[model samples]
Target: MIVWVCYSIVTLIILQFCILLIRIDFYWKNHRATSVELPFVSVLVAARNEERDLVDLLLSLENIDYPADKIEFLFADDQSSDRTAQLLGQWCEHSANRSFISIDSSQAALYNENGKANALGILAEEAKGDYYFFTDADCVVNREWIREGVGSFSGNTGLLIGITQVKAERMLGRFQEIDWWLTLGFVKVATDLHIHTTGLGNNMVISKEAYVKSGGFKSIPFCLTEDLEISRAIQKKGFGIAHQVSSGMLLKTKPEASLTSLMSQRKRWMHGMMTLPLYWKLGLGLQFGYFMGIIGLFIFMPKIGVVLALVKMALQGLFLHRFAHRAGERGSWLYLLFFDFYSSISTLLTILYYFWPSKTNWKSRIYP
Candidate 1:
């Protein structure tokens, strides 16, 4: 029984590895160069009580290489209590190309979408650009972000999912970085094959036409992972969606400050587990089984369990190392070795919360 279980787990891991390879190959073949005369771009940012982060992101936007005349900046102040509204007003006053949208709390309750989704829905309607780009308040985008990202879009492409690198200054930050990278790597590969779905709210670019055809954010069911929901909606409409993993396209964002915060964020994300494709669910189950198998086997047959754990770490490390190098992110090979064990604990806890959700808190809003 133990041997059979081990065999199944190993097979699943290898299958996942093969899928990653396919993603890399497909991306290279399909990646098109950035268009010279790119369409007018609208950079949309939604903020709530993010005074500090918003200021940084706004400063970064000021340095973008895209033409000021061709690009417009739209911001939504989602009923913030702090200096968010005042800061945005000041920003718009200083920048002629920038504008702000106000989100009325009373009217916001009428919408069934998530907070960010509600803000984005309004901004999308107000935007006058041909292409819509999104980034979080906490992220610092590279100067070439628009130059490189907009170039990859073709007529058929509806969505362009970019990469994000976690700002890791501590051990916990490192773990989160590895976790995000692994999740994204698998999803990017699976996404390219149309077998699995993944998206990050921190960075996304969608065509205005595609957004309208997909029924927009208001048309989709509200989920904590609105990015994934919108991506699926657009793709279902037969619009092409592509994943861009180049280093230049990577947006840098701060990791959660504490374990509790990280877990809360993960729980919110896992709350939408049902929204993922069957193949992604199966892959997650196999991962769960693999970790459980390691614990059970270790107790019953110490040697075999140890062997399995070591082998799994080595295989995982190789892929993570390669991904880190490709993305120009600094990750120690040593960190990857034990990352699976660390991640398994969080994954198990997140799965438990997925089945029995706790209070989800984000942007000062709590959902019980």
Candidate 2:
């Protein structure tokens, strides 16, 4: 009993220390770029059946604060069966700064399984920007999105990684928003301190030169976690990568409409983590500690574990409560307690998926 207690205490202390280290690093973000020359930026949007949101994204691009001539938008249609292609053509007919580009897999000759990467590679080859920025078609970009991202390309960074927040409209949506904020915020903070951060493909900016130097997306054409793989690849090249917390370049994505959709998404995300290298995987230690702490409490002292779990959840709520308040998300904390339970169950289900290697259905397409 004493050994278990000691182990739990040590784990909690270590996690708290790690959190503090990240907070210190974030507070003292010293890698700001001083260059004033805003390079030409190519905004790459990869879409599949995004007809519902494509128009909004294109319109948002038109409204971005960056110089229209300096910023070029490239839409890579992943052979969408919906009105996505037609809408792109309509948008291109009127928009001078943007073009609707198609992925000719027959020419680039990509395997069916590596469709997205192949499309991105073809687009990257044709992109004429000094910097390449990637975001999904379903995301609504803030007016300063491109400006803020390009501004981060200072003397030190080869890749400029930015933050993303979910647009929560419902109870489930609010839960997802809080979930992403707390979890991703901690991960980004930790990565900044430990130098093991992975980039989210949505709202990521990299110099064209660095992209070529790092071997580009072709380096991992078959990777499920292409964004993370690319970020790690950039790190392997000894270039600096930093996350911009102040710019507020939020990429708005809708939360899963159903629990089934949410589970599938979580499974896919967890399975993708398997492809990461060992050092990156070590980032999961905090998550493991949290899980073990809960389990140990329950098994060793059911009554105590129940109380501690509730207290830990309350702490998590406080963290997220602060984050939501800062991010302008209101009434999100109402479901905070429920999301805490859902997150634990989701983690367990995700672990099961990682070990099982079963087929997953996403966006009406089945992937193995």
Best by lDDT: 1
Question: Per-residue lDDT of 1-368 in model 1, one digit per residue for the tens?
Answer: 87667656855675666556555645543354845676788999989999878888988899999888889999999999999999999999987889997798675844455888888888888888888899998899988888777887876888888889887778889888888888877767765675537556899888889988998777778788888888888988998878777776888999999878887898888777766767667778888888777777777777867876777676677667666666667667777876887888888878786567468988889865
Decoy 1 TM-score against native:
0.93
Across 1-368, the per-residue lDDT of candidate 2 in tens digits comes to: 75386347535735564554446444645334565577788988777888987887888777888777798888888778899889898887886777867765463436325566666776787789999989888788888777677766666577877667888667777778777887666655655675666778777888887888888787764656677777777777877788765445566777888877887887777766777668656656555557666677677678777776676666666655554444445435568778867676767766776567677776566777
Off by over 4 Å in 1: 18-30
Write down the lDDT of every candidate, Cα atoms only: 0.80, 0.71
Query: In model 1, what are the clashing residue pairs, if there are any?
Result: 34-151
TM-score of each: 0.93, 0.87
Candidate 2: global Cα-lDDT?
Answer: 0.71
State in Å the error of residue 26, model 1: 8.4
